[model samples]
Target chain A: MTNADTLGALLLENERTRPTKPAIREKDLGIWRTYDWAEYTQNVRDFAMGLAKRGFGAGDKLCVAGNNRPRLYWAELAAISLGGTAVPVYQDAIATELQYVLNNADVKVIVAEDQEQVDKVLSLRDGLTGLEYLVYDDSRGMAELEDDAAVLSFEEVQADGVEYGRANPTAFADAVAKVKSTDIALMAYTSGTTGNPKGVMLSHGNMVRTCRTFLENEDVRESDDLFSYLPLAWVGEAIYSTTVSLMSGCSCNCPEGPETFRRDGRELGATGFVAAPRSLEMVLSEIQVKANDASGIKRWVFNTFRDVAVDIENRKAEGLPISLGAKLKRAIGEILVYGPIRDQYAFRRARWVYVGGAPLGPDSFRFFRAMGINLKQVYGSTEVSGLVTLQSDEMASPDHVGKPCPGIEVRIDDNGEVLIKSEGVFQGSLKMAGSALATLGSWKAPDS
Target chain B: MPAASTAGEVTLSVSGVSKYFGGVRAVDNVSVDIPKGSIFSIIGPNGAGKTSLVNMISGFYTPNTGSIIFQGKDITALRPNERAERGIARTFQNIALFAGMNVLENLMLGRHIHMKSNLLKACLYWGPNQREEVRHRARCEEIIDFLKLNDLRKQSTGALAYGFQKRVELGRALALEPDLLLLDEPMAGMNSEEKEDMARYILDVNEELGTTIILIEHDMGVVMDISTRIAVLDQGTKIAEGTPAEVQADPAVIAAYLGTSH
Candidate 1:
């Protein structure tokens, strides 16, 4: 067993160091409900002890399918802390698609969000012989579920842990102590757009090293906040929300739902952000639509400054020095248009914004930067533990994905395929490579 | 619904409370104990006297019989504004936001009781009134953030969407920072999404703010999802009172609402 520290251990260390600090917040009913590190750690311990009492130990796979919720994150840490591997499945997966992942992983326990997901698992319950428990976060409408023994509410699991803790006083600590760094921590399934999804096995060390390295390269502080509406199953979210945020003791905010992201984001004034290219496009389109509908003078002011912002962004990207007059014009543009737009989009406090998961359009990329948001492109895959190349602020062009992150090595072969070697690399899928494609020197400009 | 845990201290109690509107007995003899910091839902079909019962507790109507107790103190004779002063606030089934006022202004009006500025000092717009105005506005802004109404803060309440107008009414009630909040069909006329949003905000108010909520909602799904205890009112009589799960399974509740076998 590798003695290297696990992500769960690092989280415990963070708890010890900053127990009262805000760890995460979620928009509930209309309020940003906060959870401190001490509460977060206790929740994880409760889940761990509860699952442990249920005979979930070494080699057990706990399948978690849900939206971004704090409990889901705690479940992952709890599973990993006791030598169990967490498998986060996409919440939107259809029954047939979900069946494949569950059966493939041979999941022992399932922690689903609500009745919709519970129904999916229950429909396939007969086929999944290995499945033991179905723990649902939202127990609404679940009383009608036929299999009483097979299902338990999320609160019941935590209560079980509390009972277990009282019965065997040292049980929680003993279970946590049994976890080793080499243990498989998580199995994230890639979104199978064209074919069957493959599971990328990330160990505790891999996750901790990658997230720590990313933290080192970036200016992540405890004061930094993240609005995490992304899917927890996605590698990016796992890295940012579950791993790095814990590593840095920063607060992660979750929107009430998909529809409330813009409002929640503005309310949070989040400092760091990670999202897909599609979301960026949506924001761009939303801005354009609203700006177009404005009165004549307002539209004119926005359009004129928008041009100035574009010019400033172009100059910065080209590494050309800005003229005194251009700088003055950009400063005025910032006050007139850019600043308010950023505030409206909840980018007012954003120090770093990452766009990944699919290639982003250059126009959308430049648009955010033009609004004075420190937008950057992140290039990596699930096999790399979600960190490879991060565009630095100095290498501010949208055309080229910047230098590789700290402790990561990147190489290009004669075939023009990108090969990466890093501590963050998954234990499996060692030969994972992406073709450079026809856009070699023009690599920076993603497909619009 | 099974019985709610008798753990929470009873914050409000209505013993044999009944309201009569002229010849019609809008509410028959009813008794309910709302536990502190729990969502107590009053649900029934229309004309079931659910609203009438709520009106009695919120001081909108005088109960013709029996008495009401809050924190063991009898408040049966208190007026509506007087009840609000004693930490009771309410929202109407139909939105009651000031039509001429913007969202922020409407919310500020909710803080009127908290403001102690006399007209003599207020005429100069300086001194205690100025400080009080700033303080009240700041409190309203906090409610605005809590309700995610930053985008619509300056818009007139009448010009807003039905969903947003409902939200604004909720915001105004929240501005009171009440200990006991009476919501009258808060989710009525709202779409599913709007209902969900309202339900979440209500939950937040109950949990985060530690406010005891007496909710009147017809949306069974939302009521079941949020309410710690539920009372089924049918034909001006209390049919069932218990937790959501228990009430959902109750034969009497099913007969009255979901329909009888006959």
Candidate 2:
């Protein structure tokens, strides 16, 4: 693997090495549309040129708000190529919350996914003085605003990029070459449960190194597929779908919309899966609801095999060896119950499934493991560029998030707070200087 | 209150139309004008001959008396399929989608009248027939995108939720690409959120495609909000026809439908 420091350089390297390999897939018109590495980089180049033509440049922020769309991901990489930082806003944020994040970031260009998001942005336009352009990917209900000065469709901007690229052929390559590892690549805003949200600025090196170290410790490869259905505002989504895919050359699959997440996930048969505890609970409950409605004979078969699998899992967890008879029963249980359950939940091919963002219940955790899923818990926050600790295969349990990742040091203070020191730690908050450093330094004295 | 003036050329004109079923007058001398590129809604209580009047206009039930004119052409003797070919497409009060077929197949069925490949050519599935299939599929995909039915495109219509089935029915009608669209109680049996989404899609279809619409709805709030002109029908008779404000303030309309207590 190439040691590409910046995300833009990584994308360029992939395009050179594996131009025909699928880089991204999105479900559109009930079909999986593929974009190879060459097309992926070309889209980023065209969009970066378009942004430059519209006066977006170095250090400027481009706010993307919507579902996990291919265009939105490409927009993020395009901004990074132009030496700008991408700020992803939660798609479901209310107008006032959106207004706060947009104005706080001083975003110059906003790329919205569809009419719903476009309306949210336009409703707050009078208060956003720094906003220069409003770009929308879907044009379903935007026919009336075609001539509006401030609004432009995604195609129109891309067309402008084509024209600009024709005139200045080498401009996109030169811009990609200028981005440095120390430059800020992303500015993800916290959910702001306490007060106003703060923008966490992460440099290119922070993201690249963290993804590289994490991928090296795991078994992720170029052939792996990841189902990207999470909110783009979440740092975990940015890390796995964008940074990790760029590092490993894996394809990220996007569902058609929120309503089709499970269906699309099953269709993709993703090899790597990431979900929060709440999502796992939802899946578990769905299974229960379906099983409750099954015929008596089917239910009996399911229950019997499930109990057998769970019994085997408990013995293994207790450091007990399984006898040959018990092992044979477990194998039968795998074929009868666990195999079908895994296929139904789209986890049949998942090799590295991570559950994070909250503590998953032990019952639900054991239930998935009994169904032949390698479900593990990860621990981190946005401030540390997504992950600092991941549970190893043998240490898989519900209670503890396992050891610190490579290149990370974790220590517990006398006050019972965990302190982490790593190269992946964010540089600083966007507007608040020295606060993050101060918070980390305050806990460092006890350790010393 | 002043009458809501017609915006442009009259698209559909029903003059003195009447329908009868076993000596019972279903539609009695109903006459209304739908202007081009306007959303005109017809509202009334149950059994007020609202559906009868719409069926007569769509050529489902031929008027026993009076003539129907569309864009200055007399179409009183035309069949339902003939009217559909004349740029008039409609959805039923109850969803009329092909339950056995998926969303894409049902929408493609709507384009049957436009298909030119004969049986022999279609069976061969080569040259012109293949190109035609591709072209129609592209149009269907566009309608799917417009209505946000990409997720359900491959799903059976019978398996869809009530709201989504209604949307698919609408998408099928849209695949016909009609000039004047008819929607019969499109928001019936919907929750508030689904009703709101249907209203948005209706407005989008009208504004984006520049298609004239004739909507028959029971929700006064929705009818009042979206209609460019309002027509109130009661007992197979036209009670009042004007702007939403004019209809709401009319003595006959309030006493018959909106109630006079307010």
Candidate 3:
């Protein structure tokens, strides 16, 4: 919308507009470190130049495997800035499972978060003949491999890139200018329960258009804080944390580690939240446990107000008018129970919270809504760049996912299967020619 | 007892050390020379005085009859605090971390010997004191990252699982950055997976940091697999001292500790 067609261009735009604004924050060693937009762009540029110095360019694949860390996000943008596609492997994936995805994606360069991921990748080195460089962010427990020819630290690569940039001043910008909007940006692998995971290739145009359209339909703000705790391998994370934050100029917060998510989430008080159904269930379970362990009077107050909130939600959903007396009671309940509960769970500033990836249990869905969280269900998959339909704010019931996103068309076919047609629809799956062609033919033209 | 036949310089030398608890001879004339940068394991059956010998070396119990030299200095008369200052760190068989403190705080407490600021200076919190605090915190963070304790760094030690508590103890000991480390059963109550993780961390400390480790564990498989040299004790007396292969084949060690089936 702003003449920035690709994600790299959007990043450059953010740096030009708000150079000093905090673009990302990561909690490390019990302290939150903020990197402004100017710094973020500098990191992306240096890493891009570094990759370019090593013969990485268009059609190459760079794999990022690790938890939600700021360096990993920069690595993703660095790959894209060099006109190469970024493939994120799940951090919890075992060695053999990792081997399949690495081989299938034809990854040439890898940016591992720490020694754990580096070890996993090194274990499969025999089969990964295509991989040329192994870069790691944290160097702890890696003293033994420092002299290896194939391995390099993140700082070392950046330093090399700095030297290269000095020699060729405009090399990074030139490469970024070469990245077309229609170029493949991300390749995410499915879970592969039935077979090997398929790589869904989404173009820069696909991701940028989808995020822009969703932002137009929603109230996401430039001042919002988005928490990036989900696996980067998921399409939802790619859209929400990486693309959406880059486009909207919001700050993305990454927790210190997996165990610190709850504490860090509370500290950041993020304005945007996205989680799968299982994570929503975990939140509900935590609240229930805390409520049960509360003092007698506090528990009584919680249970009573919870019922009131649920009653109000149900009446509102069923199109029943609330009496003035009931409205007064609901307002009092919000002050007494719902407000504190929301604050405790770090939903106080949450303007938009979504639960997707699967249908949430009705009880858990209603429970969150009752606590004053606008918990909405989204329905989509990796094939659609993570957005086909989204529940509106006023839609409270979990019976169906809300209407289709702006400019997207969804229709049921003869076999009772859903078909989506939108600009966000991915180009095709990599290495599966038959299914890729079949998928392209299945998307019928919208009945304009 | 035969001398440890390793090639490196001896980091800790215990010559005919004996600790007596009233009438019970907890440790009777035990001698072991632990080489630098080696994983030295001490194995024995119940009541074999392995812990007693470790307690004497760590200065919790002074040897009644023998002198202990660490890094070429006799430390037999030093107190526990003095020994800790001399680069000796130990983790208990039972977790002894401060129950109310978080993991980071417990590990930070391990750096008490290294802090130079007095109570008054620390209370003022200016200049040198603040820098000292920051330095110690950074060291604690390194240990946290090394032991993979990032997730539990802020959780209370008492609330952690048993295996995690043991790991936290190990982490606290590692925070000392000692030249000689004594682990008196770091993997006592862990399942196989926890045992494997603890064993890996121990080897990492030995190989990566080059700390001299004297491990007292009951798991024979772990002891045999990771130890550079083995010392077997029976009823407060040294029975065999050699490499794992030599100790495993020794008839006296097999009859005393490893059963006939082993």
Query: Candidate 1: lDDT over CA atoms?
Result: 0.82
Query: How much lDDT does each candidate structure score?
Result: 0.82, 0.88, 0.89
Please give, for residues A1-448, the per-residue lDDT of candidate 1 as tens digits.
1123777777777778889999888776445689999998889888888898889997789998878888888888888888888999988888888888887777899999877788888888888868998999875556556358888988888999988888887776676667787778999887545567777778888788888878778898887888888888888888887787877888888777665567878888888888788988988999999999999999999989888788878877677888898888888988899999999988998899988776787777888888999999888778778888898887756677778887787777576666677777776621234522212321211111
Best of the candidates, DockQ: 2
Candidate 2, position A423, lDDT? 74
B152-249, model 3: which lDDT tens digit per residue?
A: 88889999999899999989888888999999999998999999999999988887788889999999999999999999999999999999999999
Put down candidate 3 lDDT per residue, A344-403, tens digits, no spaces.
888989987899988898878888898889899887778778888888898746888889
DockQ by candidate, in order: 0.06, 0.43, 0.39
* DockQ class, candidate 3: acceptable
TM-score of chain B of each: 0.95, 0.96, 0.95
lDDT of 2 by residue, B1-262 (tens): 1122367689899999999998899889989989888899998889999899889889989999999999899999999999999999999999888899999999999999889999999999999899999999989998898888877788999999999999999998988999899999999999999999999999888888888899999898899998999899888899999998999889999889756784
After superposing candidate 1 on the true structure, give the runs of residues whose Cα lies further than 4 Å from its correct spot.
A1-4, A139-147, A414-416, A429-448, B2-262
Per-model TM-score versus the true fold: 0.67, 0.92, 0.92
**Candidate 2 per-residue C-alpha lDDT over A208-227 given as tens digits, one digit per residue, 9 for 90 to 100:** 98888789778898989989
